[model samples]
Target: MNYMDNKISFSAYSALFNNVDNCIFTRNKVSNQVKWINKDDNDLNIKIKNEKRLKRILFNEIKSLYNNRINRYNLEGFSRINDEKIKDLEINKFFLVEDKFKGTSGQYSVFPRTFYCDKCGDLRVFSNTDEWKHFDVKNCRNKNCNGKYKQFNYVTFCPHCGQIKNIYPKCETHGTKYLKLIKNTENQKYWKVKCTKCGEFIDLYYSFCNHKDIYNLNHSISNEKSSKVMLLPVMQNSIFRSVVKTIVDVQNLEWEDNVDSIMLGSYLGKFNYLFSSNDNVNNPERILEYITTVLKTFEPHKENPQKAIDLGIIGPNLPQIVSNIENTITEIKKNYFDEEFTELTDYLILKNYFGDNKGNKKFTEYIEIHDSFKREFEKLKNILKISEITYIPDIHLISSSIGTNRGVSTLEDNYLNHFEPHWKSKDKDIFKVYSYPFETEGIIFDLNKVEVVKWLIKNKFLNGDEFNQFMDEDEAKNIIMNLDKDGEAYSHLKILLHTFSHIMIRRSSLYTGLDVDSCGELLFPKSAAFLIYSTSNINIGGFSFVFENSMIDWFQDVQLDIKDCIFDPSCLDDNGACFSCLYLPEFVCGFFNGFLDRDVFLGKTDRYCVGFWSIDIN
Candidate 1:
């Protein structure tokens, strides 16, 4: 058995880099269309930090892809996503491959399959089979031709159905086989394809191709439909949108497993600091104190703590809430697993807690307020209207891309739906996915809850009555999170944080020497904060390094950059954003660069200074 081995980054194997299931590939110095071997190696499997939620999200994505397959194959038995437990069988064909891969194929050919011989001026189109043996030896079919064959770097793409086709010559005499490629100008866009026999040529271009003629795409159209196919360079950026989803290795604290009693106790511990002084587990009176302290923080329950408790509002488990708190609170000190807060609820509760349970450097986070240059940090945080500047020394991320979005950069739903779910072969179906692991260091800027609400209301993105009832940060966060989609405050907060994150990334890139895209942002709008960190596989000691050494410089540069865009008067005159001011690469910006406005950062360039990051804070 012959084996071919190749080395490529897991990132390169993604559809983003063009080595997808049916796309053309450039191996060594030669290029050919490719298909991965229908088998996967377990060694290639990597785990995302939050596998359960990751599985749920990926199941939806893969299921959509499998569903998109044309129905005529009678490809029934599509399994529904069972969120109860995401087992191996759920992702059977998903191959999470690493850096290197090996496989053997029955046949591989230069895509377009069209070649030109300079010596005899003959153009030859090879068949998909091995019948053309002489071409394999690096020579042309013309009897007296001594020149080597050269492949064209162009192919035709169907804008309608995403089908790729080989270029065909349009001459009557020699048809496609005896054509010659004539370069009319230095630019290939002006080049022409000619038939030597007829002395006739047409510009290398896009035209009509019958959809039914494409080999495997069967479900979309009838045999009579013809569509205009665009001629694109093989490596053009628009050919595919690599559908990779990168998520933080978020840690869920099993908050749901703890019922109402222990829940109230946790709230008491975080809000009232009850755990520090109380040691008696069975003391009945301290339990009331814990419940009362927790209730007083809520406006509706403050006037009647025992009434809410008796009415089964706070801890429905009754005696269990008190007993579980006594038992579980100390277990955290002895045998409990380490805790790392990633979710908004956990971060919201614990970040406000003074109890000292934030875990180590590896699990979830290690956050300490940015106080290196106390004065500058205070000024920057105040100007940015953020309450805390958390510096996490280590951050880990898992990212995976499936399928290919062809013909446009806009990733339409149907394109994502077309990713192959499983390789089908007579009970040999196996799930495969390619996942890449990245580790780096970064920081999170927690916005002031009060300021966020004020900004939202001022911009009319939020109603004053919405969050007014909840003064406690935790209560406000819960209410904010549970609000429906029309609650414009939730989305605008994302925009404010998203736009703020881009400014930091663009500024940090200057210091770190990484492309702005190499940095990724994760917005916890519910928490009113965003985590900006290195997305690159390599860890160059990112956000923390600058935090320790040059945070002031970092803050200063960001302010100067945003204050005056080179496209100023015009850009600020518009939405307060343009490419020159705040736009990031399409894939880099989490929102597809939507909801961004420099006005969010600079507020109004008008007489009224009403922006969140506006320098005119009174």
Candidate 2:
């Protein structure tokens, strides 16, 4: 046979090297059953397993690659070896030998699995402490990956080439700090190098603290040198930066599982109230007066379309009703208050209802007598519809303070003490025309819905005899001292009746879950509104003043119509007295939420037995 034919084929050669049984069979020096090494044969084994000798060289090459010591000298040495011999050597020793090329001298294995360049071998470590700094790759530097590189210090280096790496963009908003590895040439311990574009040292845990030296490779940088980083704007507002960072992380949280929709809706409602609306424009204070006047005009015979012509009630024939309102406003100012419509329509409403007990009827019956009043209410509704607003406040917020905060004996005491002064009257004639009420505790107590109606019918001669016992001439005189000959008592009585009617209706409705049980005006405190609006669990029994305060914004200025200098005790609920019961203002502040579908908290829709009309202040 030719020598070329005797040469082994690639497969046969690999089989002989890789298969232990085949090696024993081909060599014939050992049996497959027991080819064990022995001390006796040590010197006689000079046949030098060619595979073992070649493996020694390959091991040195791998070690050099890890130390980053591969150079011209090593490459020349590798060239002297045969390819097949080297392959056989590597395969035999692969499992037993350490992969020096995959780990740094003092670090863990970088890519213990595979060390090929195409695999992009890298070393990564993580530490809550600063000990493992060098050899830590916190993030991929590759522009596209943007992957976080773990911080595994001297534990390992880039297995591919033993190169050091870094973690970058520690905080994206600040976009200033980057993490690099630092270690002494012969030292095992490592340090982190934070090179920040903003120049200030960012602490790892307390991320915004000044600690440049800890992150600086050389602590030799002077204070002035370090101060250079201070000039940056990014460095100046650290608190803002921290907040931004916190918000970013917080935004990533799972809020969907925690907060319910009702809470979200409430939060949005408050936010919108603060930022939205132009209701206060032109004359906010007067808006409530305008609305009140429009309501009072509906009191029987209070409206005189004839007066529209008599006073010329402002130049006739305006295209829109608002224009008519404007004219009436002009007439009220020109003919009444001095030609300038300064009284906002809202305030005008209150003034007209309280300022005059007109038409010789009990004030309670005034709105019922006036046909023009109905027309004005309709007009106000149309104006509100056009404006597309949620609420036309009947009351205005003039001033407010918590009773408890005033150092009073109690909240109740504070309210009573503070509002007592408004009970005093300046002119008896003005009082007589207004029929101001006695602010006395007992009288104020009787001013509620049931008692006021009794008073109204007695003055009207409707139920005169039966209610005569409750009516005292001296009390009526005290209340009527400052009044119209026909008397302002009725006007004063109407306002108290109207507003309290709402409170009464709302209170009754709140006790019972049913909505239709109550009628007339409704006072919906926030807690009641929340209960009414909720589709889930509701607990009205536990409701109290605190709950109301927490959920609703208080109505501010309110001018109450009272019958005498004595407090209209009728305004008091069973809950005891309040300063507001002593004297009522023209406009008051109250809270409103979207009430029932057809029933708005304070919007126009006279159909529901109760409605509110939006007045045009301009």
Candidate 3:
């Protein structure tokens, strides 16, 4: 056989071996008849009984190609044995194992069945259902075999729910006693069950029923199609090494004395009007002004309370005034503090970006900056050495904490809390879940940017005493611990970069004909790099076109966009983001819209006055 054929045979062998091993490990005795046929000799049928012996034989067979590192597959955290175990193991009527390497042009079957041609020795597998029985005779590949095939009817027990039944039942809501098995264009099998009473369609149970094997060989084969059979270790090691290097790089920078310096802190105890007013207050500004006026009148009472009280500067109605202000603010907050986007446009935008992408292509780009902010642009250019790149996007599934850890409460807590059940339940693992794919258009920022930012924080932005006051040793230690483990933390530079990325994503979406949720951002604050890109399934070609056609215009527009917000002045004075501005859909954002402050990007707001844009070059 050719080398390509040999690799395919080995992959199939590995898959089959893993499946048998899984079946045995689960103590499934019903489907014990596992067979492996030799490609060169059709008469040779190897009945696999001892899984350990089979592993040794297979390991020896592939050892020459993979060296002695074949043992890596058995290691904890890397092996199929460590994967989630299948709750139930039931043998269908029959299982047919096919030799893909030796098979004739049309001999191999998509699923396992009991049909074995007596003349050609070609085995055809089908789903052990009534619908499959009707097509079994017609599916035989050998034309001269006279449509002869054997069928086996064997009963098996379900490992999950401990049910021993001939057939899985459909939802009772559907009048049909059972679901009908159907195949899509991809040849994937699923049971179609529609509930006429409720008009509800359910696919989840069907997927669960079809993929019963703990080690799904079909899924393994499909996943391995894009990967090298022998280079799996090399790829895994490369990723591990890159992550280690990033962590080590961060640790090495710790020697810079100002590493522990606090660039920003949560507005917890600080007397900020933003946190003082509750959601019910329609106009926080007016209430804040009134409070300021009331406080100023108490200035004389600060030194001489009795004299001021006698003068009516302090009165019997003081407590009533305080209660009235507090109640109004509380009522306003209770009414208006909502995280869910009110408009259908927001939902459509989110769906466009995160919903299943039928087409397997996506394009993204960095918008150019305007000439007016040329100085800030130059600084950014210097920090991130921009370059063109081309590569497949690496998509990842990530779960994040719902609420912000900064002590400042947000409307997201109420909306996102609903997902807590799904997060905990294995069955309903859909809500608040997100898939993020990286864009090739990214830059590796200059390390000097980190040093410069650190220097600015230590020397120019904050005094030693002020820095110490904000820096919490225990909190810093906890952050470092999290960084070492998961590479996530609330570093000053990270917050700055994260905030900047949000502004860019929001602005880019508007110009690129994409929704703000369609655009996602990746921040590498440790490296001072951030990438903003499209998260849509199909290549809209809008971001790339916008960058190419109106790069300067896009950047100029972004600068204008971030300079002011619809809820501005108030948004600036408060937490620095709102539904009308930086907050993005849960799917597109990594941080869950936490640690965002536009003032950190624009430097125009009274709060967080020190910003990258405001940094003096001299």
lDDT of 3 at 364: 25
**Which candidate model has the greater TM-score, 1 or 3?**
1
What is the lDDT of every predicted structure here?
0.55, 0.23, 0.34
Give the higher-lDDT candidate: 1 or 2: 1
TM-score of 2: 0.16
Instruction: State, as a TM-score between 0 and 1, how close model 1 is to the true structure.
Output: 0.64
Q: Per-residue error at 489 for model 3, in Å?
A: 9.7
What is the TM-score of each predicted model, taking all chains together? 0.64, 0.16, 0.32
Taking the candidates one at a time, how many backbone clashes does each contain?
Answer: 13, 85, 11
Best by lDDT: 1
The list of candidate 3 runs beyond 4 A from truth reads 1-490, 602-609
lDDT score for residue 201 of model 2: 39
lDDT of 2 by residue, 172-269 (tens): 44433243333324342222334344444333222121213233435321222111111111111110100000000011111222111212222212
- Candidate 2, residue 103: lDDT: 25
- The CA lDDT at 252 in model 1 is 36
Give the Cα error of residue 424 in candidate 2, in Å: 29
lDDT of 1: 0.55
